[model samples]
Target: MVGIIGYGVYIPRYRIKTVDIADVWGDDGEAVAQGLGVFEKSLPGPDEDVATISAEAARNAVKYAKIDPKEIGAVYIGSESHPYAVKPTGTIVAEAIGCSENMTCADFEFACKAGTAAVQTCMGLVTSKMVKYGLAIGADTAQGRPGDALEYSAAAGGAAYVIGEEDPVATIEATSSVTTDTPDFWRREGEDFPSHGARFTGEPAYFRHVEQGATNLFKKMGTSVDDYDYFVFHMPNGKFPVAMGKVLGVPKEKLEDSLVVRHIGNTYSGSSMVGLARVLDIAKPGSRIFMVSYGSGAGSDAFSIRVEDEIQSHRGEVPTVDDYIARKTYVSYSVYAKYRRTIKA
Candidate 1:
């Protein structure tokens, strides 16, 4: 009975087309878009940050759970973009969400999979009776160096999950994680943007870690990809998930609805959590879900979720992920640059 009691996501309405970047750099827009399988990416408004996004998602999760916020005994936020170098984003989120003063809170950074790591921690706390209800958030204002390959895909957004035993929307069937010390991406102290290992970010990094996590989950739970109705992977871009799905024998249709990285880019820690929220929005009462998340440091977390009956009542109650997706307003590269603060006046 221990699982997600509620979930919510916050994605900015602003977007810049992938072709816009190629246009600026005199690269092939069509080829770039087709190659990455990402056409656009969400951009945070000047007022938005990891804290604001986390607060919105946490508030929505509380509302969806229909519980007193004071009952929240723990809050964990996963993100690399904590506003302060030393302050904890979890406490800010907890205070904004109205969680109790004596709450267990911390911020996590494991690259993109940080959000799922928070989820795993909350699950443990709630199931262990250490917390009545725990809040787990994955949010990021991810950035890419201008003209870099990641510029088109590194973007901003986040999602939150409330986990408990009371009236869950889904139940966790199984979970597994695999990690290695491989360095495919890094941003040094005081570095403005991250540097990647170029061709190394793919083969031995993202794909290898994600595939290993998925394969381990399959063997651990004795469940096949065919057992799930939908599948979601850490979408650094549209291409990676599809390519990994193929390697794992998952059909395109099963991965389609959750393949949102094509539209929103990578939200870093929020990447896969947002995808899971989208899947839950349309999942049937008995549908099964498969999710695997990858962080650039070379690690992946995989989980199996079975939709609960309570999901039917809440599916249309909140702002649908589709609504956010369709309500986008396009922005030019110059405006996008200004919004991201990458361009000095």
Candidate 2:
């Protein structure tokens, strides 16, 4: 019975309101905020690259897992934003988190779904006894081509999960996945941000993938969305997940507080896992949590998890979504452009 032994998350310290970006262009930020349900998005500093963000999340997860660094047998980093195109960010993260050299390490990419994809893969390694414990990290520093609508919500953040044998903190009961060759959003080589068909990204990319993944998981398990204590979805923006929930017959009441859209923006690869970490902060023993993640170029992964009695004891170590949101410092468009290195100094 392999499961999630511990979890952690990292959100950058800077924030930029949609209005701030809109204000500079004579556009109404209020309308954008209202439509997207996002007030601000996080921005990383020069020193905090994807590796650093992943390292922080791994540290927090290890702390809560109560496992020694040397005991970790594998590490998988999921990021489309690896700092170096040629080198592996997983090794750097393993070192930063103090994992042993005996561990297996690699990076995975599937857009935003890569994180949970790593989770599913790690579970396989543990269940098969190929390793004692494994770490899966989802981190991203998403770029939205300057002045694009994505620029207002595409953000940076990371989350890490430790997967191992049963008697664990959060156990995976079942899992399901769906994939299709859909180009709702994509970026070719040498592209900084992604390219999307705009309106198509919602129905074709996000909603379709998530709804199918969740429905298939629930139907096969013979359980409905109402049976779960909480639900989380990949939030590219606020509206997509909420809309998907409605179409899937998920109770509106169950989703209200769990949607992380307005507060954290769309964290690309880290979106759904980060939201799961938020729910873990308040989830009770015996609670069931359902999670679904979608990546553009389109794919979705869904999982069923049952919280253990130990969850309450470990929640204190991970920072809440609110904690991260409050510490953010604001930056103007000019400064944002400089930080992103989109402009020549």
Candidate 3:
């Protein structure tokens, strides 16, 4: 079956509380936390970058898959905060995971959904027999302006999926996407931080795309939301996923396991996929999962996956997402600014 053979996630150890960012902006941290349903955001060390995060996650996937890295025929990394403007972060990740020169590699950027887009591409390669395995990674050291609303949620993390025709932990039943030219968020050349359309990023972009993507996938699969045992939606904030879940008729119990955004903030490209990873960690064999992701270009990708007995097989090779989430070291706003390089002096 063409699906996810293995998956791994990496979250940085540092964190900044919503109160910390609100303290800097003279806004009410409690109200901000209550509004967004996010308490803290994971932060990268000064030494970390997207490439490093991608490599670490891919290594864990290789371990989980128990496959030789050289057997992986392609590598795709999706992120908006790629370290080099022109260099492909995928190449760095491939080499780090011990992939050969013969493997194809590229980077993807469509905001948060780029990661899942990579997943779909990998599925195609494996299904076509062009590759024994393909690695798709959604990683980002996401950026938020000094005082913007995003500062409380934009965070650093990533996940890697090894897609192949065998040893799948979850097999894909169907996938679909919906897109439009919605400019809810953008950062022009050389801008250190991205700009957004405020409330514009919500109704017209995130909500619309995710709803349409999920609805179309359900129709294509000839099933309704009630058929899936679990659901994960792109979480730019904690509330959005929950809101969209209710809109799609999925109950809170189906969404509770996927709601890590409340703790780790939004990992951008890694957002929904990471949420799916959390669900897979605890899901029972034969469980069905529905996932949808949103990006600000904007667009959404939806997928139906069936959990296999294989998920219980390799998930213990590395620390779980919850393991990483529990191992945090909080930093003050000043230290966060320094590590994120918002201040030079």
Q: Top TM-score: which candidate number?
A: 3
- Global lDDT of each candidate: 0.90, 0.86, 0.93
- The residue-by-residue lDDT of candidate 2 on 1-345, one tens digit each, is 789898888999987889998887778999989999888888888788889999999998999888887888889988888899878999999999888888899998998888888888898899999988899988898888887888888889989999999568989999999999998877888877788788998777788888889989999899997789888888888888888888877787666666666876888888888888888877889999999999878899999999999777777676776677678799888888888888887
Taking every candidate in turn, the Cα RMSD to the unseen true structure, in Å, is 0.9, 1.2, 0.7
Q: State candidate 3's TM-score.
A: 0.99
Which residue pairs overlap in candidate 3's backbone? none
TM-score of each: 0.98, 0.97, 0.99
lDDT of 1 by residue, 164-241 (tens): 998899998878999999899988878889999999999999999999999999999898988999999999888989
Rank all candidate structures by their TM-score, best first, as comma-separated numbers: 3, 1, 2
- Best candidate, lDDT: 3
For model 3, what is the alpha-carbon lDDT of residue 173? 87
Worst 10 residues of 1 by lDDT: 312-321
Model 3 worst lDDT window (10 residues): 310-319
Off by over 4 Å in 2: none
Per-residue lDDT of candidate 3, residues 1-345 (tens digit): 898888899999999999989988999999999999999999999999999999999999899999999999999999999999998999888888889899899999999989999999999999889999999999999999988889999999999999998879899989999989999999999999999999999899998999999989988999997799999999999999889987888989999999999999999999998899999889998999999989898999999999998888786798788998999999999999999988996
Better of 1 and 2 by lDDT: 1
**Comparison by lDDT, 1 against 3, better one:** 3
Model 1 misplacement above 4 A? none
